[model samples]
Target chain A: MNTKTFETENQLIRAAQAGDQQALRELVEQYSDTVYKFAFKVCRSEDDAEDTLQDAFLNILKALKTFNHRSNFSTWVYRIVSNSCLMKWRKEKRERWESFERLDNPEERIQDSYTHWPDSPAEALLSNELQEKMDEAILDLPPIYRLAFVMKDLEGLKMEQVAQALEISLPAAKARLRRARLFLRDRLEPYVQS
Target chain B: MADELKERILNICSELGEDIDSADCKKLRQHVASCQDSSAFVDSVKKTISLYKAYGPNIDHDTSSRLLGKLGLD
Candidate 1:
């Protein structure tokens, strides 16, 4: 839990529940960057991320009155965002599975994200170099491992948050992260030497 | 490239609990300070950190406004 929520967050929660739109807006705005990032990362598409973002807060707002203020607002929102994003991910995964005919041939369908960072970063060359290596490394991870690594390492979430978000146990989170790191290390070894 | 060292660092990254211990933070800091000693190793570390820093969306105000609007907060 962050300090902002620790000290007198109940006031804001009350304000939000009482129909203070700005309070709700402040809360959403503060967390939206992270939310949007996560949505985009999971969906790998702007349209989907946009939809995920809208869907998340709309869900939150609809249930705002009944929301227990005991948990941190950030945690609550992370729960919402993660649920929505994972649902989208599951949908996509399902689509891919259907297309693959079965799960055994996933390697043939794996998206090789070459040149992903070239157009996505402030400094083109460095971004391209790092992202090329990084994407290859991350894409090499298994489904569970990639999700854990992305949630913890990429999104700066705590292990507890990752476990909570993914609805898995803490030890499960740790194992996946370990798997991701080993996968990345192997993928990155040659590039790091260059 | 000992499997053990790689396993250890990966464990550190994996065990990123909500409350990071001060000792863990200190160890990370120490590693950071010496990261530049080897280009390859530094690059390896940089790949992960840079990837983490790079994960967010490059969204615009138009999209933001639309999202906010849909949330009824615009």
Candidate 2:
């Protein structure tokens, strides 16, 4: 949600909790696209994103009464959506940190030797090719790291709020964000240079 | 860059958290100015994030409506 809408979010929450269907609809309408976009970015599959969107909203409605406002509403919703994504893929092993070994050695690419992109990010338009690379890089991250990266870097959440949403320590959230960022930077190196 | 310096640069880049001009990032800004590799690495990381941010996909109207319908809010 935008900052202006968030200024009045508490009032909407209070009304929704009081069984006000209109207030509840307002919340759903405002957050549905945000939730779905986050899910799609993290899940990377439209089908999975849709399923997560439904599950997250249902969970949010069920748990709304107990929401004590400790974390802001968007953070709470992110938590629910993250949990829904995690649950869907719990049986899979997602910790793939070892795959990052190839990109770990920044020492090899010294100051003069660093790969320079042909253009700055601002000058570069969003080509379909770069978009695919971005999607592929994000998908390559482990789910835990993906969640932290998405919430902080992509969704523009604060570090503390990201920790709250992911149920991890502040430092742990920072670590995940770091690894995810470096992993992506390395993945896009060749494409940007090319 | 040494391992220690590289680690420090990466940490500073990630923890800067989109607020490059914040007071906390003063040391990072200074370091990037002096160090070419760190600057490139930091710039690339920021670019990676900016690219993703620029290309963010929105939930189509029909999909969002279906979600609301499933929740009985439609």
Candidate 3:
């Protein structure tokens, strides 16, 4: 919320709105990395992520003129990218999904031993096994919930911002986040706690 | 641990959010101090989030450049 930063963003938006190609490019460049990372996390495939990124910016380009600027530019960008991701991938069917009741059941979590996972050192977190498990766990989530989880947890957006970006009510967003976290925690339990 | 205690502790942990000083979080911590299952569950969930938060893989340089080209901005 620095005044200078906010003013600079305002300037950039005005320039882009006025058909300044350089301004448009600066806008894209500033957000491209974030967009790509988010797309990758949601789509969980390089090809899909790339396509989503391209589709997202194309949408941004088309909508920039009428953007009304109601939301900040970053939130607007996230909204577009999240929509692109859902539209592109939500149709794919999964073999099965863990039910919410099953995930929340205490009986399902009752392991004989109650040891916690080791402190995840940076090395372990960056290791291939952990990364692959995280990727698989994310992909296993239904697309909508996956988007919510990625936005709130991985991207570190606030709960309100997540609801805004996803066009959902705050409680709905929180529900998705809680379930997504539960699913992921269960998937990772054997790997970490064992 | 009784199933009731287990469920209560996990519920508290889930609702804790990021406010460590909140009353619910304080209660959860107090319960976790005496409950191994609660302690393990909290630790593992925190670990899961931290692990995935570290799993960011960027688009390669070539891919980024190609994106710009596709957009006719290069």
- Name the candidate that leads on DockQ: 2
Query: In lDDT terms, how accurate is model 1?
Result: 0.62
Q: Per-residue alpha-carbon lDDT of model 3 for B22-48, expressed as tens digits?
A: 577767687566867766766666677
lDDT of 3 by residue, A72-138 (tens): 7788889889888777654544322344345443232212221112245564545566655666676
The parts of candidate 2 lying over 4 Å away from their true place are A1-7, A91-124, A192-194, B1-4, B14-21
DockQ of 2: 0.47
Give the best candidate by TM-score: 2
Ordered from best to worst DockQ, the candidate numbers read 2, 3, 1
True contacts kept of 2: 0.57
**Model 2, position A17: C-alpha lDDT score:** 84
- Candidate 1: misplaced stretches above 4 Å? A1-9, A95-122, A127-133, A136-144, B1-9, B12-46
Please write out the lDDT profile of model 2 over residues A1-194, one tens digit for every residue: 44234357888888888878888888988898899889877876677788889989999999999989776888889999999888876754344334555655332221111111234555366565665566667666668888988888888898898999999988888888877776777778866431
Model 1 — interface RMS deviation?
3.6
Per-model C-alpha RMSD: 5.7, 6.9, 6.6
Please tell me how candidate 1 rates in CAPRI terms.
Answer: acceptable
TM-score per candidate? 0.69, 0.80, 0.79
DockQ of each: 0.35, 0.47, 0.41
Better of 1 and 3 by lDDT: 3
